[model samples]
Target: MLDGIPPLLTALASGADASIPDLAREVPEEEWPRLLEIVRRHGLTPLLGEAVLPHGDTCPPTVQDALRTHRDYAMLWHRIQMNDLALILEALGGASIPHLLMKGTALGFMVYRHPWLRLVGDTDLLVPADRVEEAHELALGLGFKVTEEWADAHHLPALQRESNPPIELHHQSLYVPTPEPGYTLVPVDFSLLDAEAGTVDAGGFEARVPSARDALLQLSCNFGSHMEESIARPLRWVRDYAELLGRGRVRWSEVEERIDFIAPDLRTTVLMSLALARPFIGDSYEPALLEAIDGLPNPYARLTRVVSPRDMVHEWTTSPRRAWHVLSCLMGPWRATKWSLNKLLVSREHITRQTGLSGDALCMRVYPIAFALHAIYHLRRADRSRGE
Candidate 1:
């Protein structure tokens, strides 16, 4: 995967017209499709193709057609998600849910390309904690089914409907599950940013997104939460951060002030994500911000450089392989200890939900075996990375 980095990074960071045939020649046939998938997962399929089209790489006809097809489907999904967003906004409005559209929807429309080329799975709706129940009921009234709920996390739960994309009614936009630095059970209040939110028309559905400063801050928090969850923060996030920085609207002064005001802890979150994103997305950060990122103490800030990030689903169904991957991902002790705590304490209910396992003795028994195997796997990986 790393071998394809040159072309992939060129596609993302450069605007030059390139021959696709020439780029293809650099990558052996066996590695081309993998390269395509990497760019596609990073939400750069069409953009990469656009970058290469002028130079004209001699991509095999079939490979070119496949990328074209993937690009078309991604565009179509974006449209469908928008249509779903419109219906959802209309429903929430009718119910007076007082919700704001989060992440993909807002970024796709406002920060990204005019047509919004990325794919959105579910539309995230931010509702006040006090009104989460009302919003959940509203989703139910609109024929959406409640699929899951997490009281610990600020999100009320998830709602899905066949007619539209799934709606996640969020009481909290950002959640940090680990206590390595500090423990805050209540996810950060996004209402603080609501005042700065401005409305945009989402295919005739009036919707709101945070101002540029808040969006960057909020995205930073979300990225931090995903990392805390031991979930691979996707490359798409890197793209989003890149584009958000490119927007001239961001006010660093206001953003830093808010960080001081609302969640000063996210100072590192913002710094780290920016540091990690620059390699793939070319640097667009302010000089002060770049200096701040550079000055961040290592061990934590440098995790992005040490780890291979991927966006993998986090659920009970995720394989043991993923657990091992996360276990071995960053600097050892902290992540390892946290994984064990989550497995023993935080994950019992998750395991029960997935496997119907219950009782203290049985669960504790399962933990010993799982922990030992995970430990062994981590050691083996360390040995491999060390060539021992």
Candidate 2:
């Protein structure tokens, strides 16, 4: 599975004619559409258009034109995003709320060659934990409505308004729970990050982004968490890490010291991210940094080394492999086993919610039968769809 990067992806990412004369030429004519779909799904269409549009006559006119159209749409989408960001930042500023931009939106401004080149799904803003509720209310006052919520989530339920991107109002850095007892990946201290954060000129406005070190930590942890959530694209995340490293803002020595002092458990998450991105990054990063990452003990060495980034993408797209990948992400076999058990023992309220059946004494008695019938129905429906 660790064979190598996919050729089409290499062509798209590196834009090297030596890799392929035409990106479309790398795949069969019939497969070109599927390839384009993969790129779009993986959040590479903006870059794809930019890469292939310049090499006229190399790719099919239809391919080039389609990519160019998507590229133009991405640019237009970016304008909408920027408008929303400005409005959100203005609201926060007017209220005197200390807010720092996080994730893709911030990286777009601070690291990417062009803000639109980095595809963003939503705007992530981190406010002080105490002010998060106030900010959430502010978002509501500004017309955004809550779309999703989870009790233990790091961010408040996601908020969105019509004609604008969703907003994840975070109170703290996200954390990943490891198999190690009572130990989760180290989370960034919002206060420390806030103090060290620097402002970027976001088109007539000043918005704060996390310090380089904190930003790297956040990306690494996010990679781990999103993998478990089945919403991550290896190519997208690896590109993020590679781009960030290319900026040369990080101090490896200081990052190492911070990891060691604050939480060594975070080392694996950071190492895994860099290690995966290393192949794509080529000689951009320090050899010493690679050496240090290699020297550190990696419990997932076999799993990480054996699975290529392309394999990661496949694991998400293909079944059985998808199940296996999710199991691996449980951190350990014992944890995975425990999780399976806990899932089977879900509470009565969960059953009530799922079946919309009353939780009365009679319903409680019949709940097992009802749940089994529901499961059977779901499995049959899935099988029918698959067969179709």
Candidate 3:
């Protein structure tokens, strides 16, 4: 279980009535840096400002300055993102393309008290799968260039405008490629989200956001998949869920039903996400939802003593390897075998793109060389771990 969670974070998540002044007074000046790092790591810098800036005098001058800087930077970026979004929305609307905002961009408007309080690192806009290429064309027409690699199965390559955040035109909400060619383990049902979507006004234009039920499920799927895949823990997701649930906006029954109907395989993932956010939600969670979570099959039950934010933070921070190892075990041997086979038999186009090399002979030779290098990488990591 995670231990030594800074009290500052707990107070921050403790709702509107939390005594930020008392918490700030109790915090040692020396501890500010560590707390700030934790907050920053979780994408909570702007949120920290919201909670602490009102009681700024209680904090150290340096910490106050840092918080202000983070808040100002986030606010500025947020405005740029909104302006860029407005233009993109206009372009898409003109083309008669249907789009729904997803992830942080959507959650900021739907859940947060103030949109800027939710820091959007990038904009995620979902378009119908069939229309994604057309949407991609529209994005390019708007002078946004593909600043990255070729489009993946889930979305077009991230498009960026000079001096602004990147935009991802998504055909799928989430995609987890499996070792099997032409198969993805997790592909969100766009129709469900699209059908139940609601519109929110972004200054001058209207943008679609997933309904509360869909929002919670999408967040759960994203959060659960990340943890299971050993992706970095971002506390902002917990905050988003906390805000939605704390305000009594979510319909737990609908969310649970949707999960069961569309993706029963993700039941555990959804539970893990909810379990992690449950403490932060205080008394807001529905009793039936808690009961359902308790009743769900928990494969990771043995791995974690407590499924709370503190423990999650501890697990990720103190020993990322342990978290990875547990997730690897949960992923099972079949997935590992499939992944290895997939790597060995990578597409010719991918090989050419990656190595700038062509021909069957050269690509065949790359197979052995790639395997050796991969083996060496893992071997070195194992040796380092043993030595430590």
For residues 18-99, write the lDDT of model 1, one tens digit per residue: 4434565577667767777556544457666554444445565666777677666666666766776666677777777677
lDDT of each: 0.59, 0.65, 0.68
Model 3 accuracy (lDDT, Cα): 0.68
Candidate 1 vs candidate 3: the lDDT winner is 3
lDDT (10s digit) by residue, model 2, range 1-388:
1345457675444333344545455556676777776776567777766666666765667788888887787777778777877887888988999998998778778777677777877778999888999988988888888864432357888777774567788887756546432225355566777887999988778999987777887888887655533335567776677666755667667677767765677777787667766666646678778886676464555555656666655555333335334545545544443332222234446756676764354254543454344334434423322201
The candidate that wins on TM-score is: 3
Q: At residue 18, give the lDDT of candidate 1.
A: 44
Clashes of each: 11, 0, 1
- Which window of ten consecutive residues has the lowest lDDT sum in model 1? 309-318
Arrange candidates by lDDT, descending. 3, 2, 1
Candidate 1 segments exceeding 4 Å error: 1-4, 13-30, 49-58, 114-116, 149-152, 180-191, 228-233, 247-251, 302-305, 308-346, 349-388
Off by over 4 Å in 3: 14-17, 174-191, 228-231, 298-300, 303-308, 315-320, 332-388
| Reference-based TM-score, model 1 | 0.75
Alpha carbon deviation, residue 333, candidate 1 (Å): 3.6
